[model samples]
Each structure stands twice: as structure tokens, then as C-alpha cells.
Target chain A: MEDNGRTARKRAQILEAARPVFLRNGYVGASMDEVAALASVSKQTVYKHFTDKEQLFTSIIMDTTAQVEGLTKMITATLDDDGDLARDLRALARGFLGAIMEPELLRLRRLVMAEAERFPDLGRTWYERGFERSLKTLAAAFGRLGERGVLRLDDPELAAEHFVGLLLWIPVNKAMFRGGNDLYAEADLDRLAEAAAGAFLRAYASPDTA
Target chain B: MEDNGRTARKRAQILEAARPVFLRNGYVGASMDEVAALASVSKQTVYKHFTDKEQLFTSIIMDTTAQVEGLTKMITATLDDDGDLARDLRALARGFLGAIMEPELLRLRRLVMAEAERFPDLGRTWYERGFERSLKTLAAAFGRLGERGVLRLDDPELAAEHFVGLLLWIPVNKAMFRGGNDLYAEADLDRLAEAAAGAFLRAYASPDTA
Candidate 1:
């Protein structure tokens, strides 16, 4: 058990060190020597943890998806309860905006997209595990709301798509293209969250509530 | 004047040849030898027209933005006239969807994003000339609609952002990550466009129309 725990800790350290390496230098340009030095391990130890750079990079990306689990839980917790629908939605939007727009996350996003063509499975897996997982969670919550008569929607999945679309379209694209997060202030994100929530309510709220 | 015409033709050929090479090989991987050979010109001629690979790449990306002029014109032509707003909106959405989802364009998008960090100015220029230019035109049209009392909106730019976010959020991401255009069919795109138009109307249409 002690041996296993030590292996796990070393594995975590390698991933933590390798993520910024990949993010900064890109997949093709990133070097194993840099990863080993950053992790404070020998190259042989790095190879023991991961057989190749591809494996190491994939582990780093998959590790980021764990962050999405928190978001999925937030979606369920916020939308499943009996509460003010718009208020819950706006808060949920704010949570999502904040999570996705982290500078590190943005950098990782660029890295994934940058390497996506070279590693088709990496892109596909990230999309399924990270992006779609959150959307699916949001969709299920929206479906429940639709059934509960708080929201009126023919398709919960489509509604969820629009919800995120409205919230993320501007800032996400800006950060993706511009390579930084300074474009929007905290107040700007809040306003975007409110606007997305407001538009969603306008589109989905039951007639009486609307 | 004859020399100038020949020079223009050779420059165009090099550009055409260079685009596919850069798209296929990526920035760091692309070779000027391949570009010159493909264009059936001397390496000297290739360099004569464009000083370096960066210049060639930037020119190719910027050249693509000329296509956006058609979209901007469509926005004005469709929205300016007093026509069926829903129908016009759906048509415009369809146009945006079709133009952006072209397989070549998708590939170029991935290329620009991949090189975004390496060539920050290229990404910024593409975003400004290609992405923001379209949004600005759409916003102006929506602004006109709001003033004409055909739509209700406090901010036309935000409305424009929401409009695209709703229309593009799903398919664009899918294509970008999957690295293919086959995920969505013609029918699927039309359906997405119609859905976006319907949702936009729900959120923005005048109450009298509602």
C-alpha cells in the first residue's frame, strides 16, 4: 500500500509538471527532458510513469476533465432544487463562465485544439469527457425542469446548448483567439452570465412566469 | 503592365499552392520547397512575392476574410428590407452556417488556432476581420431592427453575440474537435439554423409579434 501510494504521488507530480510544459511549448515542441526537470525526476522515472510523450500528454488532458465533474455536480445541485429558476440559472451560468475562462484552462484549450489534428482521439476524448459531459448534465437538469413545468422546452438538450452558447460564445472565442483572459473584466463576465440567463429565461420560461 | 500582370498571376499561384501546403503540414512543418514546387515556380519567385513563410501564412489567412464581405452584405440585404423577419433570420443563419462549416474553412480555422500562439497577430487579425466583422454587421442589422420596433433589445452587440452563440456553439465545436465536417449533415445544419432563429425570435421578437 505504501509503494502504491508513492507511485500515485509521483504520477500526480509528473502530470502537474507536464501540463504547463505542453501548454507552453505545444505537443510537438514540448520535450520530455523539460517535463522530467520540471517534475524533479530523472528521465527514466518519467518513462516509467508514462511510456511516451503522447501518453503523458493524454494523461494531462484527461486529468483536466476531473474539473468538469465539479461543474456537472453544480448543474445538478443548482437546477434540481425548488428555487427561483432565473436566479439558479444565472448563478449556474456564472459558475460555468468562471470555470471555462480560467487562464490555465484557456491555455490548455488552445493546446488541445492545436494538437487535435495530430491526435484525433485526444480531441475526440476530450470533447466527449470534458465538453459533452457538462452539456449532458445540464441537459438532464433542464429536462427535469421542463417536466416540472418551470421551463417549457421541446428539447432539453437543445436548450442546454443554447444556454451555454449564449453564455460562452463571446468570451471563449475571444480568449481562444487572443491568447489571454484580460479582454473581459469580472463585471463583464457577470453581465454576460446575467444576459445569457435572461435570454434563456425569455426563451424557456413558462408563459405565466415569463 | 504585362510584367505586372504576370507577376500578379505568379503571386496568386504561389498563394494558392502555399495555402494547401500550410493547411496540410501546419506552420512549423510546412516547407517552402513544397510551396515553390507545387506552384511550379522557382524558390526565388516564391520569396520574391512574400518575404518569408510568416508573410505567406498571414496573407493566406487575411485573404480568406474577403469571403465575409458576402455575409455582411447578406445581413444588410436580408435585414434591411421590411420582410418576414423570422424567414429572413433563418435564411441568414443558414448562410452563416454554410459558409463557416465548409471543410476547407474548418481546416483553416484549426490551422489559425493552432498557430494562434505562435502568430498572435494572425489570430487577432482573423478574429477582427473574420469573426468580429461579421458580428458587427449583424449587430448593426439587429440595431436597425430594434429601432424599427421589429425586435426588442437593450444592446444590439450582445444580441448579435447571443445570436451566433446559439447558432454555432454546437456544430462549430463539434467540427473543430472532431477535425471533420461529416458529423453534421445538410439537414442537421438547416435544423440547427432554424432552431437558432426560432429561439432568437422567442427571446427578441416584439411582444406584438409574439
Candidate 2:
């Protein structure tokens, strides 16, 4: 059991080291020797943890999906708040932007999208596991809001899409193209979040409820 | 004057040939020799027209921005229609989606975004020239609609962003990640466009006007 625990710890250490290397160098340019060296482990141990560069890259991406769990929880907690719908949604939008617009997350996004052509399966898995999962959770929350007459939507899933679409489309595209996160100030993000929540409310809020 | 025309024609030819090569090989892998050979022009002629591969690539991207003029015209003509507002908006939405979702355009977008880190200026220029130009035109049209009391937006720019966000967030992201345009059928696109227009109307249509 102790040996197994030590092996798991070593594997985690390798993945921690591999993330920045892959982010910096991209898949084609990244070298196993560099990853092993960065991990302070021998190439054999790196190979023992991950069979090859592709496996290591895939593991790194797949592991990032776990971060979405925090977002899922945030969505549930924020939407479930029995407060002002607009206020709650704005806070949720801010949280959504804050989580997604992290420089590391944005870099990972760029890295995944940049290599999506060469690694179709990795791209698809990342989109499904990371992007779609969060959408699904938000959809469920919207459904609950609709049931309570807090919102008026024929389709909760579509509303969820609109909410995120309004919030993310401009900032994410700017970040993706500009290759940086400094484009938007905190004030700008807050304004964008407020605009998205306001638009969503206008589109879906129960006419009488608001 | 005839010699000047010929020079211009050769420049055009070189640019036309360079597009596919860049699309296929990306920035790092593309070669001037391949572009000249494909254009059936001499390498010396290619050099005379374009100083280097970077200049050739930049010119190709900058040239494509002219296509947005056509879209701007389309938006004005479609939205100015004296017919049903819903029908007009749906037609506009459909056109917007069809234009942006072209495979060649998607490929160009991927090419620009992939090299965004390496060529920050190129990416910024493309985003501003191509992407922002379209949004600004759409916003102007939405502003006209607001003046006529057809829409109820206090901010036409935000409304334009929401309109595009609703229509494009899902499809564009899917294309960016999956590296293909086959994810949606013609009917699916129509439905998406319809949904976007519906949501936009719900959000912005003058309560008494519609």
C-alpha cells in the first residue's frame, strides 16, 4: 500500500511538471526529456507514469476537466440563492468570467484549440468533458428557475446557452485572438457580466415576476 | 500603365496561390517556394511582390477583410426590408451564420488563431479588421432599428453582440474545437438562426411595436 501511494505521488508530480512544458512548447515542440527533467524524475519513471508524449498531453487536458466541478458547484449555489434574480445572476456571471478568464485557463483553451486540428479526439473530449458539462449543469439550474416562475423559458437549455454566449463570446474571442487576458479590466468584466445578466433577464424573466 | 497593371496582376496571383498553402501548412511550415511554384510565377517575381513569407501571409489576411463589405451591405439591405420584422431578422441571421461558418473562413480563423501567440499584431489586426468591423456594422443597423422603435435597446452594440453570441457561441466553438464544419446540418443552422432571432426579439423588441 505504501509503495502504491508513493507511485501515485510520483505520477501527480510528473503531471504537475508536464502542464507548463506542454503549454509553453505545444505538443509537436515539447520534449519528453525536458518534461522528465522538469519533474526531477528519470525518463524511465516518466515513461512508467505515462507511456508517451501523447498520453501525457491527453492526461493533462483530461485532468483540467476536474476544475469544472468547482464551476458546477458555483452555478448551483448562485442560481439557487433566494435573492434578487438579477443580482444572483450577475454574481454568477462574474464567477463564470472569473473562473474561465484565468490566464492559465485561457492558455489551456488556446493550446487545445490550436492543436484541435492535429488531435481531434483530444479536442472533442475536452469540449465535451469541460465545456459541455458546465453547460449541462447550468441548464439544469435554469430549468429549476423556470419551474419556480423566476424565469420564463420554453427551453432551459437554450436559455443557458444564451446566458453564457452573451457573457463569454466577446471577452473569450478577444482573449483568443489577442493572445492575452489584459485586454479587459476588472471593471470591463463586471460591466460585461452585468450586461449579460440584464439581457438574459429581459429575454427570459417571467413578465410578472420581474 | 500596362506594365503597372501586369505587376498588380502578378501580386494578386501570388496572393491567391499563397492562401491555400498557408491554410494547409500554417505559418511555421509554409514556404515561399511552394507559393511561387503554385502561382506559376518565378521565385524572384514572388520576392519582388512580397518581401518575405511574413509580408505575404499578412497581406493575405488583410486582403480578406474586404469581404466584410459584402456582409455589411447584406445586413443593411436585409434589415431595411419593409416586411415582417421577424422574417427580416431571421433572413439576416441566416445570412450572418452562413457567411461566418464557411469552411475556408473557418480554416483561416484557425490559422490566424493558431499563430496568434507568435504574431500578436497579425491576430489583433485580423480581429479588428474582420471581426470587429462586422459587429460595428450590425450595431449600426440595430441602432437604426432602435431609432424607428422597432427594437428597444439602450445599447445597440451590446444587442449586436448578444445577437451574434446567441447564434454563434455553440456552432463556432464546436467548429473551433472539432476542426470541421460538418457538426451542423443546414436545418440545424436554420433552427439555430431562428432561435437566435427569437431570443433577440424576446430581449429587445419594443414591447408595443412587435
Top candidate on TM-score is: 1
lDDT of 1: 0.91
DockQ of each: 0.77, 0.76
> What are the per-residue Cα lDDT tens digits for candidate 2 across A1-210?
999999989999999999999888788878999999999999999999999999999999999999999999999999998888889999999999999999988888888888877888899999999989999999999999999988998898898898999899999988888766688889999999999999889888998877
Give the 10-residue window scoring lowest on summed lDDT in candidate 2 chain B: B176-185
* Pairs that collide, model 2: none
TM-score, cand. 2 vs. native: 0.96
User: In DockQ terms, which candidate is top?
Assistant: 1
Task: DockQ for candidate 1, please give it.
Answer: 0.77
What residue runs in model 2 are displaced by over 4 Å at the alpha carbon? none
Q: Write the per-residue lDDT of candidate 1 for residues B148-187, one digit (tens) a residue.
A: 8999999999999999999998898887887656888899
Per-residue alpha-carbon lDDT of candidate 2 for residues B78-111, written as tens digits (9 for 90 to 100): 8877678899889999999999999989888888
Per-residue lDDT, model 2, residue A178, is 75
Q: Name the DockQ score for candidate 2.
A: 0.76
